[model samples]
Target: MAAIVGSTPTFVPPHVVPPARAIKGLALIAGFLRNPLEIVPQDAYEQDYVAFNGLGPRFAWVTGPDLLKTVLLDESDKFSKSVQIEFFGPLLGQGILTSEGADWRWQRQVAAPMFRRQDLLSFVPVFVSATHRLLDRWRRSPAGTPQRIEADMTEVTFDIICATLLPSSDATVGLALEASADRLQRSAMWRQLYVTAHMPKWVPQPGARRIRAAVRALRASVGALLTERRRALSQPDDLIRRLMAAHDPVTGASMNDEQLIDNLLTFYLAGHETTSKALTWTLYLLACSPQWTVALTEEIAEVTGGKPVSSDHIDKLVLTQQVIKECMRLYPPVPTTSRQAIGDVRLGEHLIKAGTSIAIPIYAMHRHQKRWRHPNAFDPTRFSPMNEGDISRYQYMPFGAGPRICIGMAFAMIEITSILATILQQAKLALADVHAPLPVARITLHPKGGMPLRVWVP
Candidate 1:
């Protein structure tokens, strides 16, 4: 492992201090809409499993690493993506993320080669240029200016995904998609509420019409871009071109227009949001921990040796990557994942009945008392090459585990490292205000309010 970066990091960044008691009844539903992390009882941070019976369906909250493996891996086949689909199906369609069974299998098979390590590495230059553009904008601001970094991160990541996956997107379409992301997330939350209460999909909710309109407009934009991608047959380097040419080997079939639109929207929305949250949190941590920030800045200089941060420097920036890993551990992008049982089943000597919902509150798991020495501290050494292997795969899964793991893991990591390295090389960012932003679970783990930081060259 790379030598420890300065002393052991002890600065505990702002985090969600879960409620002492679990909220129940309408309060639970209200909490779900407000911030689902609040719904996680305090003891989930210390215990393996917690059960609830009063909800419409039985709820099983599992944080035990061994049981988590069973639910997410060993007996994964016994669970269905019902709850997840109910939440995302309206927006994402039956794409790789919301689909299951043979349908999901074939889609994953077709999408696998697109994220090859070599192909993802080739995107490093694009990622760097995107970051440079954002930095240039920040540079225009006078010194001692607090930049809206949360918004900036979102914009840069969106640019990277669009450039690599959908170059055919026009400025208008791109802008519309960006504006609708938060609205769609809100709409999805209501969808989750409807499912939990056994309400029908067509039932009315707040802002339902506007959200539906946005969904229509977003799909139309992707559909138009997909059409354009089809016309540009020579551009085989991009994801759309590659997907257009892919076929299901068993049946020798290509994706239909709807399927193409489904997957394209899946990648466009899901691809960038997670990475943006990661970058935002990592920057927040750096701003708070001066020693690690200096250590990382020094390491970046050592790795690049004054040259631009290229793909070669990514692996060499071991401490930088460790900091990102630790940041993710402290604030996972998607704080919870869930599955509904296909039938009654036994997990760790507990009987989970058919139709029961199993929730893996990842935020709680990452900070469970038994998981680490100081679960909430911002320590990167725990993720260093030597110690990382000691942690169970299920315990530290920011991108998730098993077959349904995020397909764009490599793409996200490369973009994050490239962008972070470039930003540090160009300027220093520090917290603009003393007010600490608490973690909130939205579509992504958003730091409530927003993350504003002062950017200036040292």
Candidate 2:
């Protein structure tokens, strides 16, 4: 897609990480532990592909769709999950996200039906009602007071996930996970550093005790929910219920308590966190770009006729969808991901040897200067249907691309559309602080120091 030909953008949303030259030794460790973005080079944004040999294996980072398709899809088995176990294994165990071969496939198959279009459409009310609950609080309180958008989004999305997936569970479940959320997120940075350096998870690191405590607390919560489900008089129709009934099509195996906790925690943490971060950035972009906000509000008005966001209006809110698409482009939920080659593979002209690590720094790729015109500007029009086809799927992957892409992509988009439509219908948000929050990688992309917005029903 071509750049919007006009005068310079007045507000090019915050992109604080200046492209870094290669950093090394203690500085590299410090930089990586602080934020994974530091390890990425400018070439990642300017070139289709780049490789560096270090950090336990020959490292290849690719931004082009062709090369990405080769690695993420065509040669997927040859390129297995890298370091995911070290980073999230403590929290998720041998869940779908970290498992390989038959284990990952069957687990994915079992959970797949829950995310189908029909099932996801049924979830729109939960999405709308949750947003309304948060908005109702703003309606009751003082007008100009700042609301922590990040925290608000997190809580609302967390509510949505639990309500939709674990419909039978209640306040106790929320209390269990809520207590551990902050500590767990903080621990991720250290985990990433440890995994990248090839250090075992048990290696003494910062926040190690709290991280263990957080993991234990989350697991206990899920375990209780599992027991609660088993003792129920009838099987309620929800994800938990589905998991109980599901058996592996191939192996005929079923999930035990430990496995249930593993998958539940995976969905809980991955599901809520990514969508929350996406909305947080979307609102921030809206606050900075009033024109886009006006555009979205108009679309929401025209489509819903000032009614609450319903499933019918989701597809009709095009501009609302575009703004979210662009926001994700600027600040992708999972900033980067990697895989290791199990066998020799050739991507483009480069021959990847066995054990080579392939990194896909999605944040850089989304804003890659060569791939996107006026790459850093906060313009949503590029995602418009007419222009969107001009872009390649791999070059602009916010939900990721190919087979292992997020299972909840449709769920996220529908939820995002519903929540954005509901909130924009009544609430007006403005940046409370002049300081722009830097987008940082912490399992999911989060605005550093949180996003505080002056939200009011005006």
For each of the candidates, give the backbone clash count: 0, 0
Query: Which residue pairs in candidate 1 collide?
Result: none
lDDT string, candidate 2, 120-205, tens digits = 98889899999989998888879978998998999899999988887644588877787787779887677677677677646788
The parts of candidate 1 lying over 4 Å away from their true place are 1-9, 200-203
- Cα-lDDT of candidate 2: 0.83
Residues 255-326, model 1: lDDT tens digits: 888888889999999899999999999999999987778888899888998778898888899999999999
lDDT of 1 at 6: 40
- Which segments of model 2 are wrong by more than 4 Å? 1-10, 200-203
* Model 2 backbone overlap count: 0
Q: Rate the local accuracy (lDDT) of all candidates.
A: 0.85, 0.83
Question: TM-scores for all candidates?
Answer: 0.96, 0.96
